[model samples]
Target: MNWRIETKKTALLLIDLQDKLLSVIENRERVVQKAVQIVKLAKLFSLPLYISEQVPEKLGTTCKEILEVAGDVPRLSKNTFSASPILPADIPKNILVCGIETHICVRQTVYDLRMRDKTPYVLGDAIGSRNQIDHQLGIEEMRQDRVLITSVEAIAWEMIEKAEGAFFKEFLSILK
Candidate 1:
């Protein structure tokens, strides 16, 4: 497990960020905004990306903002809280994770990924819960389990790794 994010070896996973779920998340707007930012980062850096929907028939698909920027990334439909089963076996071992219902789907997926020996860094700003307490505690619990907790900006800088470069310039443009 790498302590720092290596862009070539990492995959971005956005789980259960559906319309029905977002409608109740306390930080819905921020979550959507960060999700878009992360998706753009994935595109700019050419990182592999996956978006999981939890029973989309009832919950609805991933939000349009993310999908619009995500381009052709795989969108998985699953009944399980942990998206591990649906994910392709060949995906990168280092995962940047974000999505709705932090305590339920997001938390469970992080744990399941760890069990599979995959390193999952949960983006704090991109995930949400219906209640603030649940969101905070869920993050705390994941921290206790030794999962890396990060923000979208932190990971973006980590991947970029320097102040000067074409990638960094594009990253700045995306931030605007």
Candidate 2:
């Protein structure tokens, strides 16, 4: 199978990026920034975007920056740690995921996606945990499961595919 993230066949999934949880995560600012960047790319490419809030009432909604860039993308308010159940029916086969508490919500969501026969590419630099150990462990485990653990820049470049065109120039500006 082709492993590269084809713009048309992929969806961006942001999981449990709620304010309460994000506040305690390590490097919260970087995580949030990368997420915002990915959302912008999603909008530019018109790829389907989906977001999940573990428990909005208790955790609060997805952060302002993400929601602002995400525009009217569907946001799922779910109690389950794994977001697979509430993901929209029309979401693409390959999901690009990024969000908080890597060892828990993010990891579980990746596993569940694998079970559903969906390819989940977890954005390592855009996901975080309260501790670096948990974050690394989550990434390592996902890697062992054959999940693509990638970075925002890497995915952007892969999706862009070539160095020419107006969109390519815009993506370069975004990467800069």
Candidate 3:
């Protein structure tokens, strides 16, 4: 299958990256930092941003930094593991996914997206779980469903190919 990168046709879906959930994930800080970068790049490139909290009352809010970068993008609150059914139906095209508890929320969302015929790409480094085993298992599951698993830097650069120009320069600065 051909993997095409289209900024206008993509949305970044951040799943259950809340304080409670994040606290238990391994490499929490690193994961959040990478997710922040992804959010910044998404804003710079004009890609739509979608965030979900798995029952925010239980999981708490997504990190302040992430929420700040998210700006006006409405955050969806869901009791279900998959946010697809809750997300606005108008959001068409591929999704760039990142967040905590990869084996559960992440895997479920990817599966839902696949079932709905929407292309879902997991941002590998930007996702985390309570342990390494579950994280690896989540990625494997996503792969089995034919989801494109990739990294933030790779996806960002793919959206901004050339190393020069204003967009590229701004993107580089954000990455720094």
Which number leads on TM-score? 2
User: Each candidate's TM vs. the true structure?
Assistant: 0.95, 0.96, 0.94
Which window of ten consecutive residues has the lowest lDDT sum in model 3?
1-10
lDDT of each: 0.90, 0.89, 0.88
Residue 163 error for model 1, in Å?
2.7
Say which candidate scores most in lDDT: 1
If ranked by lDDT, best first, what sequence of candidates would result?
Answer: 1, 2, 3
lDDT of 2: 0.89
Q: Rate residue 5 of model 1 by lDDT.
A: 77
lDDT of 1 by residue, 80-147 (tens): 98988888888898999999789998999998888888899999999999999999999999999888
TM-score of 2: 0.96
Pairs with steric clashes in candidate 3: none
Structure candidate 1, residue pairs in collision = none
- Summing lDDT over every window of 10 consecutive residues in candidate 1, give the lowest-scoring window: 1-10
Off by over 4 Å in 3: none
**Per-residue lDDT over 1-176 for candidate 2, one digit per residue giving the tens place of the 0 to 100 score:** 67677889899999988889988999999999999999888887888889999889887899999888888777899999899999866678889999988999999999989888888989998999999999999999889878899999999878887788997888877777
Rank by TM-score, descending?
2, 1, 3
